[model samples]
Target: MKILAIESSCDETAAAVVEDGRTVLSNIVASQVEEHKLYGGVVPEIASRRHAEAIVGVVDEAVKAADCTLDDIDAIAVTYAPGLIGALLVGVNFAKGLSLATGKPLIPTHHLRSHIAANYISHKELKPPFLCLVVSGGHSHIVEVLSYTDMRVIGRTRDDAAGEAFDKAARAMGIPYPGGVELDKIAENGDDAAFPMPHPHVDGAEYDFSFSGLKTAVINLIHNKQQKGEEIPVADICASYRKAVVGCLTDNFLKAAEDLGYTTLVTAGGVSANSLLRRELERLCKGKYTLYMPEKSLCGDNGAMVGSQSYYEYLDGNIAESDLNAVATLPIDQRGF
Candidate 1:
C-alpha cells in the first residue's frame, strides 16, 4: 500500500510517501531549528505558525520526490497525539483536508509508535515480539512490540525524560538551543570519570527510570561552581552527565530485555541518535542479543515513521473519522482513532 503521512507534532514540519511502510518513496522535512534557536527552545505558537506555512509545500515536495501524485496514495496518515496541540492540529487538520479532497481514508498515528516504526525503514528484517527502548525529548518508555499495531509499555520515566534531562543540563551550561546534541559533541574530548554522578534507584520497578534527580545534580554543580568563582569544566561536566544518563538507560534496557527473554532489542527516538548510546548499547548487547537502531536520518520527528506505522493500522482496518482530534497527552496504548 502506498501511504502519504504528515508529521508536525513538534518543531519540524514533515511529509513522506511510503510503499508498504518500509519503503520510503520520499521524505521531506522543514526544520524549525533556526527559527526556534533565538529563543533557546521551541515556541509552540511559532511552531504551529511555521507548520501552517510549510505544510503544503512540504507535502507537495514529498509527492513529487516520490514521483507519484495524491491519486497513487492508498491512505493518509498523520500524527495526532502526544505532542504540542497547535502543532499537531496543523498536521492533523491538514491531513483531514487532504483526505477529504482526495477521498483517502485517514489513519491516526501515535507519536511514540511512529518512532518505533522508524526501525522498519532501516532494518527490514526486524519484526514484532521484541523489546524496544524509546527515548525522546518528551518521553522515555520500554515497550514490548507484540505486533505492528499492538504494543505494551513495560517501563517509563517517573519525572523528566532522558532527553529533557540532557537538554536542561546543557542549557544550564550555556549551550545553545537543542543543547543535547551539542553536549554530546563536547563530551567526546573529555573524561566521563572526571566528575562523580550517581545512578537513580527506582524502587519496586526495575525498568522504571528517574532523570530529574540527575538533572538537578548537574544544575547544583554548576551553581556551586559559579558561587565559588571557579570556572566550569564544560566538557567534563557533559561527559559525566552523559555517562550517568547513558548508564541508567542501558542498565534498565538490558534488564528488561533479559527478563522478558527477548533476543531482539530495538531502539528509537531522537535521543537514540546519540553516538555514545549507540556504542554503549552495542557493547552491552554483544553476543547476547540482536540490536536494531534506525538510521540517523529517521532519528527525529518525521512523516516517514508515521507512514510506516499507518500501513499496520490500515492492515488492522483502523481508520479515523472526520472528527479525529489532536490529543496532547495520548498514551501509546490508547491509539484512539
Candidate 2:
C-alpha cells in the first residue's frame, strides 16, 4: 500500500510516503530547532505556527519526492495524539482536508507508536512478540509488541521522561536547546564518574522510572557550584547526568525484558539517538537479547514511522472517517484510526 503520512507532533513538521509499511519512499522533515533554539526550548505557540507554515510544503515535497501524487496514494496517515495540541492540529486538519479532497482512508497514528514502528524501517527481520523501549523527549516507555497492531506498555516514566530530563539537565548546565545531542558530545570528553548523581528506581514498579528527581538534582548541583564560586565542569556534569539517565533506562529496560522473558529487544524514539544510551543498551543486552535500534534519522518525530504503523493499522481494519479529529492526549493502547 502507498501511504502518505504527516507528522507535526513537536518541533518537526514532517511528511513521508511509505510503500507496504517498511519501505520509505520519501521522508521530509523540516526541523524548527533553529527557531526554538534561541528560547532554549520549544515554545508551543512558535512550534504550532511553524507547523502550519511548513505542513503544506512538507507534504508536497514528500509526495513529489516519492514520485507519486495524492491520487496514487492508498491512504493518508497522520499522528493525532500525545503531542502539542496546536502543533498536532496543523497536520491532523491538513490530513483531514487531504482525505476529504482525495477520498482516501485516513489513519490516525499515536506519536509514540510511530517511534516504535521506526524499527521496522531499519530492521526488516524485526517482528512482533518482543520488548521495545521508547525513550523520547516527552515519553519513556517499555512496551511489548505483540503484533503489528497489538502492543502493551510494560513500563513507563512516573515523572519526567528520559529525553526531557536530558534536555532540562543540559539547559541547567547552560547548554543549547535540544540539549541532548550537545550534551552527548560534551559528555564524551568528561568523566562519567566525575560527579555522582542519583538514579531513582521506583520501588514497587520495577519497570517504572522517575527522572524528575534526577533532573532536580542536576539543577541543584549546578546552583550549588555557582553559589560556591566553583567553576563547574560542563562536560563532566553532562557526562555524569547522562550516565545516571542511561543507567536507569538500561537497568529498567533490562529488568522488564528479563521479567517478561523477552529475548528480542528494540529501542526507539528521540532518545534512542543518544550515543551513551545506545552504547550501554548494546553492551548490556549483547549476550542476553537481540537488540534493534532505529537509524539515526528515524529516531525523532517523522512521518515514515507513522506510515509504517498505519499499514499495520490498516491491515487490522483500523481506519478513520473524514471527520476524524486530532486528540491531544490519546492513550497508547486505545486502538482507533
Q: For each candidate, how many residue pairs have backbone atoms clashing (under 3 Å)?
A: 0, 0
- Model 2 regions more than 4 Å off: none
TM-score of 1: 0.99
88-195: candidate 2 lDDT, tens digit per residue: 889999999999888999898888889999999999888998899999888999998898878898789998999889988898888998798899999999998999
Query: Candidate 1, residues 121-203: lDDT per residue as tens digits?
Result: 99988989889999999999999999998889999999999999999999999999899999999999878999999899799
Candidate 1 C-alpha error for residue 201, in Å: 1.4
Model 2 TM-score, 2 decimals: 0.98
